[model samples]
Target: MTGKERLIELLKLLYAVTDEDHQLSTAEIVTHFAGQGVPTDRSTVKADIDVLNNCGIEILATKGTQIRYYFSDRQFELAELKLLVDAVESSKFITAKKSDVLVKKLMTLAGENSAKELERHLYTAGRIKPENESIFYAVDIIHRAINSERQIAFVYFEYATTKSFVPKHDGEPYIFSPYAMLYNEDKYYVLGYSEQHEKIVTFRVDRMKAPDILDKCIVPRPENFDPVNYTVNIFSMYDGEPYNVTLLCKNELMNYVIDRFGDDVRTEITDEEHFTATVEVSVSQTFFAWVFQFAGGIQITGPAIVKEQFRKMLEEAHN
Candidate 1:
């Protein structure tokens, strides 16, 4: 075979067979090539390996007698590959089918023998994967729309009682100007201005079906909009009027406060046992439910309207 063709096949063979733990002798490399009807010898094989190394493939040889060759410095280390596999397996938005496909592709980047090592650790098709296959493609379309400053249209869906997806508002597509994609609570959401709502809103990217970028342009995003603050303010991406609600929190729960509202949250140490923090949050049942879960360690201390809303919710629950 031609020299170019031989190197092409050699590279594939090396990637498939040799890693740090597995090595092929020059004779073995020639034998495999001969089996495929290519002519080569030890001298020629050594020269080809030199050329591969010059071309930036990290092929290394043994030092003493009984020399064998292996590939080193792979694009991804085994541990790094494992970490990526873990992310793919754990992501709820990726469907089990697509997750399986993606993990296998990642395995190919690891050499054949090392790929088996990765296979021992993970699989994508398990534990709370989305049923919507279109989610995978929708994220890409939304990104393109954001990059081009364009609008997009898609049918948003909610899970039915039977766990199947049902489109909202009789399957009418929601036209939107996507400004940012946000990740919260292990889910991805697009934050944008909605034509129908006439306000900024968020939609779960995974629940979007058949998303398409329109020739229409997006509305200019609010000049002062701070996406980080927006994500911090909205509890679970639920909608509500914003309120600078103050909370009396136990001093021990400082980490929890920072985790929810970030370290920059305004706070004053009220005494040895309590600190009062004023944080902007979207006031809704979800937000109150979050406070309720802390079991009185966190409580609304100000903004009488929000306090009354919390009281009404508790009273209604009591009734």
Candidate 2:
């Protein structure tokens, strides 16, 4: 083989056998190069490693009874790759088949030996996976739209009487400004400015079909529009107008309150055993149901209209 060809084979050899966890000895690398029709000795291999390092490859050598070498810096460390694998396996937006494909691709970021260790930690069993496999493609298109400040068009689907999804609004196409992608409650949602409603809205990205970026410009997002606040106000992804509501809760439920509302929740101690918290929430049946789940341990205190609304909902349910 030509000298250039021999150098190329040596470089490939370093990548193949050397990684963060496993470093090949000089003799082992020589054996690999010999099988590739490019004979290399320890001295030539050492020179090749210098050439690679000069080229910014960062091949590191460790001294032992016998010196061994490995690539010191990789695009992703093994722990980072494992975190990515876990995200892929646990993502509800990705289908089971696609999750396997993604995990396999992520495993390539680690060395062969480290990949085996990563595989052992991946546990996707019993997780709910999306049936729609084209969600990833849709997400890519949406991201492009967002980057270019352009609108996107897609057909929205709704469940039909036949236990299947049918095009909604009589197959009418939806053109919206892609604002942000959100992963909440193990599901993926795209929050955007809907042209149909002329307001910011959220849609489950998995239910979108035939998504394409449009040449049209996107409507600019509103001033001081907080996506985090919008998500916190809504319950179970249900849509509603946000209301500043107050609730009196037992002191024992402090953890649940803080967990849901975070540390920013406004609280006032009410006589030792109870406290009152005022939070902005979407006043809906879903919010009432969540309160009801507390079994009288919580009570809506203010916004007479909301309290009346909750009372009527309970009265109607009792009937």
Candidate 3:
């Protein structure tokens, strides 16, 4: 194989080996590289390892009778790495130029075959418009806060008031330890602890502004806190008391509901054209609004108060 091809193959082998174990012995490395059509000489393998290490591939070697080399650290989990690839293919908010750069970097890490496959799929994926700059900036800050274990102060825009607040602004500047960024219903949310409320809260990233990093760091997140389950149970990031909701949906919208809430939800086919589905999800104004999207096609059927609220919303909409 050509020198460049050999080098690429060697790098791919190293990545695979490092993923399983933190290190690989010289014999193991030679055997793996040799399978890639690369004649593995001791000096040549050492040179390749040096190049990879210098290029920030995280290779570390121990010098002894039988030297061992391996990746020292990994920046992304396997799932996260796959998600990044998918994001590049499906990116709507990132510019094409930026996407290309990101894809190229991912390709270098993914190896040529995986990179090419991702590229092919990306070509067919839908593209979205650039996201609001405020949301993007907030996400960056939130990620930094989570990584550094630092507290953040930010002006939060209250949707109800249509106003902004800083630390001493009309509303309070919340101090929180950021946990994770969650994507729900095409929007992004930052899940964190709200010191002011002494509870975990999810803030719409777009609504956060003027974030200030605090000097103090936060305690490590609780091991039991599962962000995914937490967000799902809370009905897409709004943390509120749980409620059981039953809705009558037209058959046309049944597929949509099933796609979202899954078939395991208690669903009854009513007549030829309607289906009734019931789910116990968190009750939040946001969740209420989501339910309202189906309008005439879906009707709330349970919890006298929730049903009344839905009716009231319809009444308000008409008047």
In terms of TM-score, the best-performing candidate is: 2
Query: How do all the candidates rank in terms of TM-score, highest first?
Result: 2, 1, 3
Point out the worst 10-residue segment of candidate 1 by lDDT: 118-127
List candidate 3 stretches off by more than 4 Å: 1-86, 93-97, 109-141, 147-149, 157-173, 196-199, 206-226, 237-241, 268-274, 284-289
Residue pairs in steric clash, candidate 3? 92-128
- On the 0 to 100 scale, the lDDT of residue 248 in model 3 is 86
RMSD of 1: 2.7
TM-score, model 1 to reference: 0.89
172 in model 2: Cα distance from truth in Å?
Answer: 0.9
lDDT of each: 0.87, 0.83, 0.72
By the TM-score metric, which is better: model 1 or model 3?
1
| lDDT of each residue in 110-174, candidate 3, tens digit only | 43334454464555435564534455566787888888889898877754454533233476687
Residue pairs that clash (backbone atoms under 3 angstroms), model 2: none
TM-scores of the models, in the order given: 0.89, 0.91, 0.58
Regarding lDDT, does 1 or 2 come out ahead?
A: 1
